[model samples]
Target: MALGGILEVVALFIPWVTFTLGSQTASVTFLDAFSKMTSGMDSFAAMYVRFLAFILIAGTLLSTLPWTLGALRTKRSAYWFSGIRRRELTPPNFWWYRTVFAGRATVMLLFHIAGIIAMFYEDLSKIGLGAYLLLLGGVLVIVGAAIGPKLTAAR
Candidate 1:
């Protein structure tokens, strides 16, 4: 979870730094113009960078749900399995937690959906369907990961 957060923060800064540098060194050289518009700033560039940051942050957070849940299940069940029976027994417990993880994952999915919708509403012309698809796929995977537990529980 901490690693996920760190990665998100790092992703948020990438575009900001790239565009900031690009703007600042606008006249320095071809690369400079490509990197920045002014010595330290560019409103237009900053806006784009901010959008990119949001996408990165959302993507990271949205995907973290299932990753974190799986890690937790593995950690929780690691000690219970034996050499020979490990594979058979471990799967049951791991799957049992899916119901719990599903609820959590659903919340994360909703959050991602809202963010994606907001992005489209904010700038209809600029919104990319690719982003929405990516978010949707991430949500579906998380939700699916949690489905095993529910199915087992029903039985």
Candidate 2:
């Protein structure tokens, strides 16, 4: 469920980023940059880039779903029900917590990598919404990876 929430947030960010980018005036360099972005490139390249982005978005959500469902199973498991807490947690299980957390970590890692890639290839002058996304995503990944386990263990 945690993973799901994180992924859903990222998926939502996509159209938001696209709209922001679309609304902005393209610099002469923006046009020129694309012109020099591999001479043989076609609309197909744009399509492929979009497709890759879509896959990353979908993969984040898809990976998260099973972890969400597993939360329910964790609640029902006998091991989880026996004094795990005074009141049951939403997921109410240790393993489930770890699994969901690890899934979240996985998504964060993926996001971090993607952000680095975008940052590397990006024209600094054109850095805008995408740079913000990358920055935020990188921070989230670092925080999650560094602190998430401690939170889980405390529970």
lDDT of each: 0.43, 0.42
Model 2, range 13-126, lDDT digits (tens) per residue? 332222235558443222233334664545443433434444554554454344434432454552342323433445334454544545554765565446435534544444
lDDT of 2: 0.42
lDDT by residue for model 1 (1-75), tens? 434344334432222112226447311221233355344654443433335435545654554444444433444
Clashes within 3 Å, all models in order: 8, 0
Least lDDT summed over 10 consecutive residues: which range in candidate 1? Answer: 11-20
lDDT, residue 26, candidate 2: 43
- For model 1, the superposed segments whose C-alpha errors exceed 4 Å read 1-75, 78-96, 122-126, 149-155
After TM-score superposition, the amount by which residue 103's alpha carbon in candidate 2 deviates from its true location, in angstroms, is 5.2
